[model samples]
Target chain A: MEWLYVLMPIAGVKIFWPGLIILGVGVGIIGGFFGMGGAWMVTPGLNILGFPMAFAIGTDIAHMAGKSLISTMRHGKFGNVDYKLGMIMLIGTVVGFEIGAQMIMWLERLGSVEKVVRYLYVVLLALIAWMVFHDINVKKKKEAKMVAAGGDAKDAVGVEWHKTFHAIKIPPMMHFNEAGIYCSMWLPVFVSFLTGWLAGILGIGGGLIRMPSLIYIVGCPTHVAVGTDLFEVAISGVYGAGTYTYKGRTELVAAVIMLVGASMGAQVGAVATKYIKGYGIRYAFGLAVIGCIVSIVLKLVAKAQNIPILDDASTAVVLATVSSLSLYILLRFIAGCKKELAEIAAKG
Target chain B: MKTRFIKLFSWCLFACLALPEFAHAAAAKVSNIVIVADTRKFSGWEAWWTNLYNESHLYFALLTMALIPTVGVIFGTFADFLMGFIGIDLKSRGDVGH
Candidate 1:
């Protein structure tokens, strides 16, 4: 294990190469399947592997750009990416993120805003988790009612908020053909702005927030949201990686090693999305949110108590949970792929 | 619950907009984290890279930025080949009609 460590040139640190690859695979599966960057999952893993915090963020973003491109390619093949919608959302995201970053800088002038930001982060995660679970329950209830009324379960209506959004005829409406939506163009723009603002305030890549926003607010199907979000992430990740690298904060060697594992994991995760329904993905995403909440809570507790061991313990817990979840996702992806191929063979 | 969540989310956003001052008043840095590593010094390519980073910062930075995504594309293409071998299609999902 000691001999497996490699030196990071820019960050001037030694990291376990295998640990970085394993961490990449775990995050890759989650990112590919959910269409989010999964930054929260990667940070602790990097920290535990003795990667420098100064470099961790830049290195993570560098790999994320590559990993997301892989996911976007696969999801695009599956008709999961909405490029037109993504472009529109990107406009809003940039402006909103700039404003949000400025706001944070302003707040920092008065005093350190770290705790408030962390609390806000946890709150956001909780809200997202609740929303995903609620959507799942609503779908379940609707399906049950439809079956009871002698209609097919598949006939149950989907989320109604999009209809309300469409009804708001404030301005020019646009059709996102790939996402199967025709609503006020302002809808996606507004939703992306809000998510991006939150992302900026939290200083995180906005995939987790944006994915849910795409699904629930913009009325994108879950699969489309994942793909579109990955598309957005890819672009933003490149910008992030570039800026951080310019600051000499990136460890390119680590990023490259991670990308190798991430590419494979991205394929598995993206392909798995084809076999899972929208609600199924939402349910899994909700669970991942809960896992994140648990990890954050542990870190908060550790900090409040000034216990270093507790902090390490929290990191260990997150690593374990993420590892298991990624493993489960991989297994599911494999099974789903095999099943789909067999069905195709039988039909042929 | 869904309606309540929407309401809460809206309120949270509003709070973020309105209360920038009040939120940071009770701010204390709760965690003091450090990244520890051995400085064994650098030689060979590592030494040259460090010198380049210090001497021509912008060029070194540009090189890293370009190299990362290029590597990503190469790996992505490799994954595409592997997926195709496993009977997976990367061209399209045939969902155009939808």
Candidate 2:
């Protein structure tokens, strides 16, 4: 009986296991598919479940790191990982995270840290959603052109920015064989550092920011960008988790349990990428960004209006939207499995 | 086929051994500076890594068996699914498969 008391600390912390389980599953799916762990999903869910905000963030990062590792490994096998690029991005990420932390401390002095951060979060979410929607339309237009030309859509030329960027011949150039690019190493480092800074300041992984930046700014192929993004996430997340824990902000028990679900989800998500074409991934990733944006917007509106009920409603909407998106990813996985079986049978 | 399998297996082994060590060395290099800078308190890097490892180890240890096979099987399955979903079936490819 005493041993049972010792083992079961959940009794002390008023948490709903069911909520955590659901949250983990949703985050895992998104994380696996997009190379972006669902920290946005997990953190808010934990907060709602009665954990302090700091604990929620700490636990989320812990789960995210594990999940990111599993996905990165899987993506690596599929030849999607660009290690050189990821490493270069690491230099930037570390610097950015530190700078972002300093900025937060500075804002804390101004006594408007919370308000500023919240407002920024809302604005960033909206901006990202807009970007994703814009990209989706661009993709559609590209597809239409290919159809009009009677050419295979797969043969469509990619964005020309990569070539343009490569021609700059900046010193200290580096080559990423997997990404099939040679460019200034400083580019990735600078981009990652900026992303890292944002991640540190906002208290979330910069994946939501980094993924798009990698694609549009750094000009990596989408698949490679996704894989590389996970690599960066793993690195930054580990650092974040450690930093928070040392500061006594981490909830060890919650983090461990969440990791259990995240690791499993990441495996499924990572492998599913193999079956999903680049365009499909792009579309889904875009939608995930939109979902996140909507969730953040609802939260902002609730806060601005000072309506407690709206806050509750926003939380529910966030949970529901995230869960549905996650379910969609799982359904995609199952469909993929069936298709593989059919192909094997046909071969026989 | 055997050679290819061997190559992949070796690569996996290398990655497993190498990455953590790389991460550790990087952390170790900064550990002293990080520790001293924050008035002998824990640095951000230390805090982030420790919690991450703690959380990850639990899941990794628990699911090691299921984890390994899932990667290859699920990936292959997904690839087939994608092709079909995109209407790129072998019948459409005419003589390509044969």
Candidate 3:
């Protein structure tokens, strides 16, 4: 147990090595599965594990860059990434984030905007959760109807947003072969800009918002969205890591150890997505949103009441929720692997 | 087509590297965030790394940025091998649209 502890000289703290590895594993699975950096999930986990608050974000981003690369490779092999679309979105994201940051600065001069920002964060999480759940419900009902009509449930095209997306013929239209989307070039650009603005306002990695936008708005399949978003995260994570390291905050040693766990976890998570339908990923992701909302509410209440224990409790709740969710995903991955292997054996 | 992609990739890479610096420079004036640690207190490998970091922040940052993803890829390749040993093909399993 004593040997499990490692000293981070830069952060001037000693952390339980295994705890960091476990945290990385959990986040790796979620990040790989959802195609987001899962920074919100990692911050609280690090806090609970007694990691220095100063180094927490830097370390998380550092590991995230590496973790996402692994996930992206796995997803790429599955033909889940759309590099062309991701690149187009990157251009829009940069411009949008700049504008959003400027708007925040203006608001800050008017008054203290911390409370407002936190409230907005909560509302955004709630709205996203509701939307995802609603989409999944609609999908399930559509599939059931198809079954009742003596049609193949697997053939049911649940949502039809893509029809509208594809209908807009603003030139020059672009085709993303990997994502199987052919639409106006402006579509991905506009969606990315919008999501990037939200991310700038919310001070998050934007992966959460971008992943959804890629699906519902840009007309990408769910799995492609996840992989493409991971590609984006990998690039953004590197930039984030660079800045934090330049500020002398990243703990490279800890990040390295985390990468060890993330490597395996990412494979499991990405493979699991292949087993499940698009809506299944959406359902799981929606649950994660609820978990985030609860955590944010706890933090807000803790801040309002000036209760230290409540803050700690909030961290605990997040850690518990994420740990459970990651475990469930891992279990599903194991089951999916076994089933796929059996199918292959049958074919043989 | 390959050359065009390479050119596009280089520009994107440039933008990715530059935006953070622009954001940080602007953020420095308005944001209350500050680095908390003192480099003087660091010793051993920490001191060495810290000194190098301070001397050339950009270089150190780039190095770190490269190191992380490289490490991740190595780990990923290792995992692929281990999974292969167990008869699971990560590359080809359930591959769909490309």
Candidate 4:
């Protein structure tokens, strides 16, 4: 067991090396699949596995920057990334992120950063889960109507907020070709700024908020939202890694080890998106949100009650959720690939 | 209409964000702490890694920023090759119906 542990040079902690790989691959697959940074789980996952809190964040950000780049490139190949939209949103995202970071020190002095952040996470996750499920329910009803009308439900979407947004008739309405949307440029910029600010205050990568917001608020298709959000996350991740490392928090060796697994994991996650389309992805994301909420609540309870057991329970729950979700996605990807291959072979 | 909406929304957000006593935040110091790794038992690359952490955080940070993306590209290309080898089409766009 002692031999299985590896020392992180900068963090100076002996970590279970395989745990690093698991976190890397699990987060890579999950992040790639959801088109988010997967930091919600990874940050705490690292802490449980023996990283100091600051090092966990810095190291995860470092690894995430690389992992997301790989996922973004893979998504780019699939034409899922809306580069134009991503680029337009970058400025607002950066500015918003900085404001959020600066405000954190302010927040800390006001007291209870931990309690406040946990409560905020609970609220945000609850809203996201509700949104995702509501959208799915709406789409299902729409699909039923489409089926009765003898129309295809393959492209039906539950939410039509984008239509109203598109009607705003604001000046400089730019088109995002990859996402097949033409809307006021202000929409994405505003959305990114808001999400970035929230991410900063919450001490998270903004993907959790950004992904859903991209779909419901910015009017992107699920795949495009995932890809474009990954692009944003990757770029911001670079900035995050630099800031944290400069502050002397990042452990590069741990990050490198994670990247080794994350590379393959990103590829698998991105490729899986080709098989699982819109509603399918949304449904899974909703479930993941629920899992996250459960873990956070458990930890919150642990903190308020001063119970170590509940904290352990929280870590177990998140790790299990990540592992199980990855396995499910992997199996689905394999099945989809086989069916596609068989159909192609039969055509010959 | 857009301008009105933006103004209303922005103001509301600003008000909410200001709820946590704005003036009280001036004293917290999250960036003031730094840690140095003990390099006593290590040699060669490990020594260099720790010494860099102790001596120059800027260069260490920059090197990490550079190393990650470079590694990502290398791994991404390799993964592409493996996916192609398994008869997975690497060149065609995915037919994800939005």
- In each prediction, how many residue pairs overlap at the backbone (N, C-alpha, C within less than 3 A)? 0, 20, 0, 0
Which scores higher on lDDT, 2 or 3?
A: 3
lDDT of 4 at B31: 52
Per-residue accuracy of model 2 over A136-179 as CA lDDT, tens digit each? 67766787899998977654433454566667777998878877
lDDT (Cα, 0-100) at B53 in candidate 2: 38
Residue by residue across A1-348, what tens digits does model 1's lDDT show? 678988776677778898888888888888999998888888888888888687787788889988998788888878899998997897788767767777887899999898899999999999999888887778779999988889888745445677777889777888899899999989998998898788778877889899988888888878899999999998777766766665566677888999988877887788777767677778888988888888788888888889888787778777877888788888887787687678878988
**Measured by TM-score, how close is model 3 to the native structure?**
0.92
Cα miss at A337, model 2 (Å)?
1.2
Q: lDDT per residue, candidate 1, B1-98, as tens digits?
A: 99989977975675455333221310121122333322347788777776676666468667776886777778777877877787865565532211
Model 4 lDDT, residue A330, Cα: 90
Higher-lDDT candidate among 3 and 4?
4
Better of 2 and 3 by TM-score: 3
Off by over 4 Å in 3: B1-6, B9-47, B54-56, B93-98
Across residues B22-52, which tens digit of lDDT does each residue of candidate 3 receive? 3563353333454444477777887887667
Give the C-alpha miss distance for residue B50 in model 4, angstroms: 1.4
By descending DockQ, how would the candidates be arranged? 3, 4, 1, 2
**Best candidate, lDDT-wise?**
4
Query: Which one wins on TM-score?
Result: 3
Instruction: Quote the lDDT for A328 in model 4.
Output: 88
Among the candidates, what TM-score does chain A have in each? 0.96, 0.89, 0.96, 0.95
Candidate 4, residues A142-233: lDDT per residue as tens digits? Answer: 99999999999887889787788788877888989999999998988888889877876786778999999999988899999999999988
Chain B TM-score by candidate, in order shown: 0.52, 0.31, 0.57, 0.64
Candidate 1 lDDT score relative to the true structure: 0.78
lDDT of 2 by residue, B1-98 (tens): 99989977975675455345333422321223111112123346544444343455444323322332243235434543554565433222111000
